[model samples]
Target: MNAIGIDELRGLAMLPPTASGHSPFAEPCLLLRLGGTAERRLADWLRQLPCPVIGIGEADAPLAASCDVVVQNEQEAQPLLAGVRRSPVAATVLVQLLRASESLPVADALTMESLAYATLQGGAEFRRWLEGRPAPPVPPAETGPAVLLAREADTLRLTLNRPARRNSMSVEMRDALVEALQLALADDDIRRVRIDGAGKCFSTGGELDEFGTAPDPATAHAVRSLTVPGRLLAACADRAEARVHGACIGSGIEFPAFAGRIVAAPDAWFQLPELQFGLIPGAGGCVSLPRRIGRQRTACMVLGGKRIDARTAKDWGLVDAIESSR
Candidate 1:
């Protein structure tokens, strides 16, 4: 809960040396408040800080890139970030990965995220979540295809068709999406690709029944390498547009984030609840989202476990426009 001023931070660097190389930021997090000029001057140094530096005061676009997360008021952030501060290693590593992923190719970035996610899956926090989770009942089998694909003139249309289950991203859906995306990639005649869902909600995230079913963390990573629709979506992003409505959780938001343009219906709401499962956004979100919104806001959303409505998504540049749901 304690915060350090820029002047005080500079002063500590001037302190007498110790044989053990004492670090002033012994706490799990470093809450920092600084004038605009001070932050800009120490930007490079702050980026290399040993602990997560949470900026206090109004959001500064430039300074946000240097910190793990920022809050207009530190008091407000204390409770919001309690989980992340408690699990400092995961949060720290997530932010570090987000920072490094921006310049990497989408495939490489996703690979990095999967490796980190697998590491966390083996950690105690994730194991605790899995232990606490009740076994899910078998969902009724739907009769039709998980996705619908149609080629219309020069445009390709893809829809998430499992409305009865809120279009949850099951393994079937993942494979279907990969096939649809692959079709577009192979056909030079397809100029525009439009993606949307068939029912009220675009997607409610991954299917609950599928959670924790992976044999092991390593196997999970292996499966994700082949099945992630986000990477395919990114490859075709140059000509892709997505229309999302209602609950856009987890894979819902992560997939659309790879599109060139995203339009949200008034009812759309977004959340990333994967941290509750003791994992980060393994669906290419750590890469896709940070490139759209800054790493700070993305970290806040994932770590804070908050819902962001459509308006907030637009303001944050997550979506290109707001429109009636298709």
Candidate 2:
């Protein structure tokens, strides 16, 4: 199978929509026709294109040069199409292919046309874009410490690597965990997630070392008012799962509560000591936790700053179940 790196594809994919200004004789377009096996694949790559491309038989050879890339052979074309069927770039295939060829096979050509139209026109549809959301930004996978690896059968397992500071949620760890959770939500393979702290404790909370001087309240308010990630978390509320052990606190609880299920170790405890530091759960904990455990309970946990054991959490319905032991 022929494949192009995303970087190279980005560069090669910049062909213009129309070849009007260029020399009419110059070959600005390319034509692609695949044998039975590749019919779908050839159609798909064309669909991702921002410019239009026509089939060789439907239009004369003039449009073929406009095609920057084409699969001359059918067998090589199948996988590319199947892979791009659900992509946002699929819509641009026809924008990549102008009105040149009607002779193209009906089914594949129609599929390409539909994809092109959507990519070109679906920008204003908020939910459509959301449905095709991109991967969350995260750190490169290689650099971090390796710690606890949490896994459930057929579910997701995340290795909480930072064992040094009682597994406090370092910025790297937080961003990585968030990115991992987002990926799990997008993946059909992951049905549940297990979160365990490295070393002795489950978590001490956010990496206080990473917490800098607080941003100006006005600035913080302005950002929260916009509510970007919060809205995204709201949308993903029903899909993720978490299993926690040891000292789950602050952002530890905040992040996990977004999961659809929460299971903690028998000795594991829950707390939101953010109030003591004059802060609240900044990562949707204020909203998510209260919704699950209730306001009075959330208040007592946050304001009272008292620790609640796993069974107490189970009684309050904070956690779904307690693990048998460490």
The candidate maximizing lDDT is: 1
For each candidate, the alpha-carbon lDDT, in order, equals: 0.81, 0.50
How far off is residue 29 in model 2, in Å?
73
* Candidate 2 lDDT by residue in tens digits, 1-326: 23333333334435542422211123223324422222233334444444223232221232233343233443433422332232313212322332222334323333333333333333333235434445434433344544344456656677677665666776556556656666666777766555556566677776654443234434433443343233334445565456788788886776677666788888788887653332445555555665577533453454346688999988988888887654
Model 1 agreement with the true structure over 217-295: per-residue lDDT tens digits: 8999999898889898899899999999999999899989999999999999999988777678888889899889977
* Clashing residue pairs for model 1: none
lDDT of 1 at 196: 96
Clashes of 1: 0
What are the runs in model 2 whose C-alpha is more than 4 Å off?
A: 1-154, 213-239
